[model samples]
Target: MPVYHSGFHSYVETEALNGALPKEQNSPQHPNLGLFAEQVNNSAFTAPRSENFKAWQYRIRPSVLHCSEPELITQHLIRDIHHKDSVLTPPTQMRWNAREITEEKVDVISSLVTMVYNSVAAVHLYAANSSMDKSYFYSADGDWLYVLEEGALRFKTEMGIIEASVGEIVVIPRGIRYQIELLEDVARGYICESQQAFYLPERGPIGANGLAEERHFLAPDASFENKEGDFSLYAKFQGQLWKMKIPYSPLDVVAWHGNLYPYKYNLKLFSPVNAVLKDHSDPSIFTVLSAPSLSKGTANIDFVIFPPRWVVAEGTFRPPYYHRNIMSEFMGLIQGQYDAKEEGFLKGCSSLHNPMSAHGPDMDVYTKASNEELKPVRYKDTLAFMFESKEPWQVTNFALNSVLRQKDYLTCWQSLETSFKEVVVEK
Candidate 1:
């Protein structure tokens, strides 16, 4: 659902002024409006099956204004390629309780705790008490996928503004400078970083009607802040954070036109395609966004969600079936209880099941779904999601040692007593 279409050749533009946008063409020289034109390229110019994303910007000033020696700053963020040390041997299941930001004040970068990362992708959790003032950030390595679970975040980006609240998502393409402003006093959420550009997954037989309609996908209108003062530009390059002093704010794009822009979508807007008859459909049906891998038909990262929807399948098991998967799954609960996890999987709870790891319903959920009468049951007050990736997720030291980590997560399945009974047939 997230990968709308190939990003190349599609020009999605939002103009804030009449006649402000250059008409009929891009890369105009010596503009009559006296605005500097710049281009941003997100992909290689000559890649096969190229979804090359390029955006033209008209701003009050060019981005070349800031060039200084960057200072390597330290933070809670951790990045690694193979992540061998983070993966626990025998592959244990892990969980974290809801983390409320009631401690010392922290900003976006300061609050980030990267749970897992490779050369291809990284998973992070954040809870911030303050906004970014006179600061901006850009990641040269990958695009960012943000899923806010607790509070709203106002993102002031180079292209425009995109605000994501609880049950919503925003994707900032790699190299787009943006700063966050917490609408609430505190904000908590998950972040997924991909080394490749993310696109709406191919709908295949589902066609264009369901799952993250491109028409519903909206980009911000051109807006810029003309501020001149001491500023800090933070960049994440080669898996390190660097800070540089600048004299002006980076959020200064007055007008822009291109498919290479940030966009926002509410998770509730997704038209879930479920099994009408007897079995649970593949969770791929719930994918909101996907980053495809080099291998065909497989994803580097699939952003899937379990939103509130109807469950009406006669003479069949309703909950998710127990199984092991090749792709590692990292799941988080944004709101109510997950259908498959009856207890202990509270709001803000996070879990990880590595490749080929067995995971399924808790004892209570299995019992209830098996015996309950079949009816059109509406699963309300719930929004759960997963970052299902092709590669196994390696847990960070922070994730393993955090106070929020649950020590007894493995006990949720301990109550599944052996029910294997041999039935003798009477002739």
Candidate 2:
């Protein structure tokens, strides 16, 4: 089992070796134990104190020793929405069935397929059968938020090791070196890459008690591996993949202290806040994390989840109402059925609603909720999530052409009938 310190973004100082971490100063003329000191800055050097994030690592070898001449690699399935060759579809609703895991052995990096993306964020799905061996990867373009949907994964990072299974998530800051090791025969998951760093959303009127508590987020304790061999380093930079041969393992940090490090949070620990007696609360109430954009209230991306919760709304439709919004939404089913969707939507499946695209309960869900008795009920075993963003997501060429794309998804709402009743009133 891996040990973790409790708290979200708290300053953590951990050392794998005794006296490996420097004391009284971030960097000293001669660091303790002859370890090289290196600092990683995630934000502008002069950013606000609260927003600035940096980490100092005391490692046996500097990161510069882990690099060599880079070679370009082909990752055709991975794409950028703003790329010249990216495809833009009309504003519409779309869904895709779960992709079949390949029988051929592949690692996490080789299995990634971009579903949709914008300038600031991208959504990707991956299914891998083999663990990365003597290989490590880091994304210079953005931080990665991993949502495990099936099987388990062990992330060995420069700072420490984090293991996450289904119903959990891991957030790795951009430029953090890590390698994914499979703990199961097969692993499938969703990845949200965002240029903006994810932060806990502020609780205004709801106060500090409800919704993801700070203590539930866990950061790994210091751990290091002293190994040298023929290793490969992969980097996703400027929307392209690059590779390089390294002579030694990069996960050699013996000690580190900082607020910027990879961390994991179990989704089950999320304390959901919702409507109790009236109508359904906006999905924002279920946000687990938000990546803020330049706009004040808007978000570059909001990772929201609809977990099992009590439904006690009276004299109101129990399911989500029909609506359109400015934010583009990419939704995925982790398990069970989404309340607003009766069929077609299944575990591992995904859907997209571009900006201002009308989407809501399907015809079956609407009809059932319309006549159902209004009583307190518990929604059990259901887990759905959405990657909501301020910018519209453009479909990747591979996603648009995938066999998993459900071409008949729009028909689910076609059966909705016009139930308007006009009554004459006394004038």
Candidate 3:
């Protein structure tokens, strides 16, 4: 799927209601700052403050984040809210909280982001299906990557529904409402909470030559709607949760026009290439979606993978095509096995490859692919992905505190050796 870097609207949350001192109220004591503050005394807020009335002006407002997240928004928000008057969790009971944060360090990582949260984060994912419920599709405020490791999901969102397989992935951004129906007797996947929005992998000198392509991304065909029903919606606002009852299907926007909207693409759509000469190419060739960073033309994180592709670089040890990156990369495997980590890495497990930290397929896979025949070979059954980031992702409690995580992943490469004799060495 084509991915692009995205960020918060900075103003979407605060600008609309801030009662800043407006210029109209500016009388030497105060000056109106923005639109919301401009209407200060207009009743939407309290009374407008005049520029000249600084010292005599106002009483301090309480903390906005102080109340349960849901209450904070509902008290002032006026929009098409999905109210959950049915079997929905309460507003204050959404997911775990980020009480105290701790960061982890690794070497040779991709610019990709791979984060695991234990008792305090919400686990989520994204998927593209052919036949499922439209109301099952939803969005969120942060990045939610779903790892399909166990069964299949007859998933649905605004984009439509399909049967998602075990190796597939599904992403749901904050604020969108979606639901899931199991096509199998059981449905399970890894829920990756990307506090950072996933974006398009950055284009360096290679430019658009690699990574996810925009045209590959598919959006909902038409705004599907439930025209005349009073249904309940489970809205997870801020961290607080609440239910909103509306007269129509929440997904009925007809057509949306914004980079902020959600879309799903299968990694199976990826088109990869190997070299005809010696030396392997970059892992970025496997990029799916990327979220850009605050830096000028840099990525916050790039979702790359080590999916099955040709190992055609002639004369060079072909696996991974080895090297370091300015971007940190985190890699994970699904199904079969990854050549780079044939011995240690396993399904449902992960590894961190930091910026400048050099990594490649294990010495074994590197040597075998290098020495093998040069004829075109199609690698199947292997599925690996990377989460590259411009910044080092702070390892959350989920990654560190969970029994579901592997602490030994840091030492995964301890047994790699340099004894492959068949593959030709690069000059």
Q: Give the top-scoring candidate (TM-score).
A: 2
Could you tell me which residue pairs clash in candidate 1? 2-200, 2-288, 3-199, 3-200, 3-201, 4-200
Two-way lDDT contest, 1 vs 2, winner: 2
Give per-model TM-scores.
Answer: 0.93, 0.98, 0.57
User: Local distance difference test, per candidate?
Assistant: 0.82, 0.91, 0.45
Worst 10 residues of 3 by lDDT: 34-43
Report clashes for each candidate as comma-separated counts. 6, 0, 97
TM for candidate 2 is 0.98
Cα shift from native, residue 311, model 3 (Å): 1.4
Question: For residues 134-194, could you state the per-residue lDDT of candidate 2 as single tens digits?
Answer: 8999999999999999989999999999999999999999999999999999999899999
lDDT of 1 by residue, 363-392 (tens): 888889889999899999999999998987
- The residue-by-residue lDDT of candidate 3 on 1-427, one tens digit each, is 2223223111111111144322243233433331111111101123333111111111122112122223222431111112211122211101111111113221100001223222213332222222232222233335566667655764444323334567566666554545566665444344554545565654566556665566655443222333545444444444333554444554432222223334556677666654667666666556676655557766655667677766555556555556777765555566677676676667656565555666666556765765777765667779866656665433433344545455454344455666758978899
**Native-to-model Cα distance after best TM-score fit, residue 332 in candidate 3, in Å:** 2.3
Ranking by TM-score: 2, 1, 3
Query: Candidate 1 — worst ten consecutive residues by lDDT sum?
Result: 1-10
Q: Candidate 3, after superposition: displacement of residue 105 in Å? A: 36
TM-score of decoy 1: 0.93
Q: Is candidate 1 or candidate 3 better by TM-score?
A: 1
Give the winner by lDDT. 2
